[model samples]
Target chain A: MADAPETFEEFRKSFSYGERSDLDFKFMKSLSDDEAAQFLAGLLAHVGDAYDHARLTDIIDYVIDWQARAYAPAPDAKRTWVYEEGPFATPAKPLADSRVALLTSSGHFVHDDDPEPFGVVGMTQQEAEERISEFLKVPPELSRVPVSFAPGELRVRHGGYDVTSAALDHNVAFPLDHLHDLQADGVIGELHDEAFSFMGAAAQMRLQKETAPEWAKMLRDAEVDVVLLVPV
Target chain B: MCHVSVGHVGRAIEEAGIATTAVYVRAFGHVVDEMKLPRVLITNHPMGRPLGPVGDRQRQRAVVASALSLIDSATEPTVVDDLGPFRPVGG
Candidate 1:
């Protein structure tokens, strides 16, 4: 484990790094800022003795269950909770000699390429959140961006998390800039001419069954040897 | 959900014969296990900033480097390297 956090501020930062779910978001929404602080304080009190990964996991599990029981209108159940099996592939060649491509779920689109990509372009944040489930039912739209695409022309639209940081610097989610830099430094052999983006906080059935296979074929046709997936 | 969706996408791409490594915020590794992605590098950054905080190129490069290491070294299904919480300097 990393060094145990010392103060509440430190604890908060540490906790933020942990994984979160819809339940956690709703549970947090239910808590006032003061209550949230108190909860953090309660957790902070146990930092040293019983704060290992397993124990923290147990606590989180307990809180999730408690939230389900305690809240009047429980957090909306995730409609698509299916976990289908997936296939794997081993690298045919070393990274130093293989062509690489990037695929991200950061909801980025070219500025003028698609005016209303994902159908949530002009909607307010409130509207997008209200209808995100509906949006997920649509087939995943792959936004094919050339590696040479200008970073200044990228625009982000995603309802699952705060887009402020991504809007400011897409490298937070896309990382194409760094990938290009790595390519220039010969960390990898070559960057594929195209990078891919799509909204990932979706039901995923269509993505898995229909769209993803198409994406795979495209990458294969392009002779990409490796793909780096960055999920926001 | 992003982790799960991205895992699915990675799976399809890999199944097509190209190797893949998913870099995602650490949430629901068990689900990733169920999906059986070939390799994953889980970071403790927030959901939106999976690479790291915005504008931190050094930190983002560290994440990509970690992912590359996972890709180069993984020998089985679901190889994971959890690089714990990367705090930006003086944040």
Candidate 2:
């Protein structure tokens, strides 16, 4: 424990894969340089000196599994079909002059709006699961969050991943404030007056078939030149 | 939270004549490629913090700026841009 590796290079040497796949090693290498630093700092700081190869591998395995489940499509969802003409759209204007909008999948809504995001909140674990199972059978609605809304004026309602980070600062997931900053800097012509959000872990089949066209039409009607999609 | 759903939504938006650039975790690069999304920016940050760490305004701003830039540069469908490692304001 006291001899836990201090660097990723050192850490890499602690394990050997004579007959096993190196999938886990590749996953660890995918961490950005700064993320790697944060990963090591947090591991060394909180894990203290009791780290071992098995323990570290267990952490990696858990993360891999969690992410796999989080991003997998709902069972009821079938493969998505792309637009025949293709989905590429050239910006009609430069970013610095284009009206940019943000559309997030963070399941956020204005405090007073009281949107029901799959109605999973406050229910027991079993109840929530049942609610989500039924909810995923269709496309969910979207909430329009004002770009200038205050902190306490917003609320989050999502089932995937812990919402604490976004709860502390909605910008972590939505980034509306930063978009506003970019607009102020003239990096973008304008921040669309409203940003949109919705629960993302739902039926993609229904989303593409029904809800998505409506979202597209609305943004198109607003003359939005470019949209940034942020998925929680 | 759901990169696949986001990709589908982005596709719909693009089909409606609105340019779209989606931010996705690098871990899901395979899905983005498989789906052939119009435009995408890859970030190595964790799932919940797609832009960056909480309250780290500098990094978040960088991510947003990059996404906007991608809108201007991408000339074809399925264009993916790697934001590379995040370098803080003055790390």
Candidate 3:
């Protein structure tokens, strides 16, 4: 490969489309003056070696994608909602009453609360479990126990803004895997069919558009009626 | 870490005109103040998994219900009351 890409297209098409860390330098050039400056600073700080410039470029590209997603025009028609997992007694039943939920990823959560230190909530294990139990309304015996939770933090300068972001202390717990288990076992009245995991804070518009079609299709496929988002 | 892409996706879906409800676990206070999105649920949970820890179905259901309720209740951007910190049985 040449030391520097001559065109934006050449730079954008250089990396694999899906790798989160790959930097599309061409995309960086296309950024508005503000975005471009942020991209360059992030590149210099994260990409210490010339060889790693491509990776740095990918991160920048991801940021650009975030900008696009953030500013995209709102759609006019009612779109379908999808969930990843939940309880549905009948697979063929209509989802008119069903709701879609969103779960946030640790990284994006941090960005949402930029400048705040990670795990500032200082939630204790007892507090975490109690909150989980209350949120789900599950008996102590049926609830999945959390084993571990940790925080991840990052700092980046973008668009004349300095961002110091940190993920909440992430907790890893056993899966309450079966939706039916809740209802069949008398845990709740209905199973929602699916739940969601969110990392929206990390998403760029370009990438979201590329990925949204699948989620939209999932809602269509499952015939979901409502979407419920729970931010991490 | 909870990736930023997730929020964008939700926004994208919302922009697509779907009646969407976003439950922000930790940044509820910030989202309500900053973005001006509709039907938001606020909690002080971590990222990646929003409905509280992973496998607690009851909490998940409540969170879902809270978010769903927002569909009809949110006339403008609104934030549901906080569920506060998690506590184990009778703690």
Which candidate achieves the best TM-score against the true structure? 1
lDDT on C-alpha atoms for all candidate structures: 0.70, 0.70, 0.39
Candidate 1 lDDT for residue B53:
67
lDDT of 2 by residue, A1-232 (tens): 4876376544433322212213223233434456555655755644443344334433433454434443445546554543344567888998899998999988788878756554544333233233555657667778999888987898876655456678888887898888888888899999999999987867878887888888999999998999999887
B46, model 2: CA deviation in Å? 1.6
- What are the RMSD figures for all models against the true structure? 9.8, 9.9, 16.9
* Number of the predicted model whose DockQ against the real structure is largest: 2
| Candidate 2 CAPRI category | medium
**Candidate 3 docking band:** incorrect
TM-score of 2: 0.73
Tens-place lDDT digits, model 2, residues B1-91: 2677887788888889999988887656656776677777777665676777677887787877877788778788655555454332233
Error of 3 at A74 (Å): 27
DockQ values for all predictions? 0.50, 0.55, 0.15
Ranking by lDDT: 1, 2, 3
Instruction: Give per-residue CA lDDT, model 1, range A1-232, as digits (tens).
Output: 8977575443333322223323234435444456567665655655543545435543443343333332223246443544455566888988878899999988887877653635545655445555667767776677888889877877777666667788898888888888888888888899998888887777677887888898999999989999999877
Location of the lowest summed lDDT over 10 successive residues in candidate 1 chain A: A15-24
Can you write out model 3's per-residue Cα lDDT over A125-221, one digit (the tens) per residue? 2333223223222111111111121223321211111111222212221122323343454433344444443222222444445655556456556
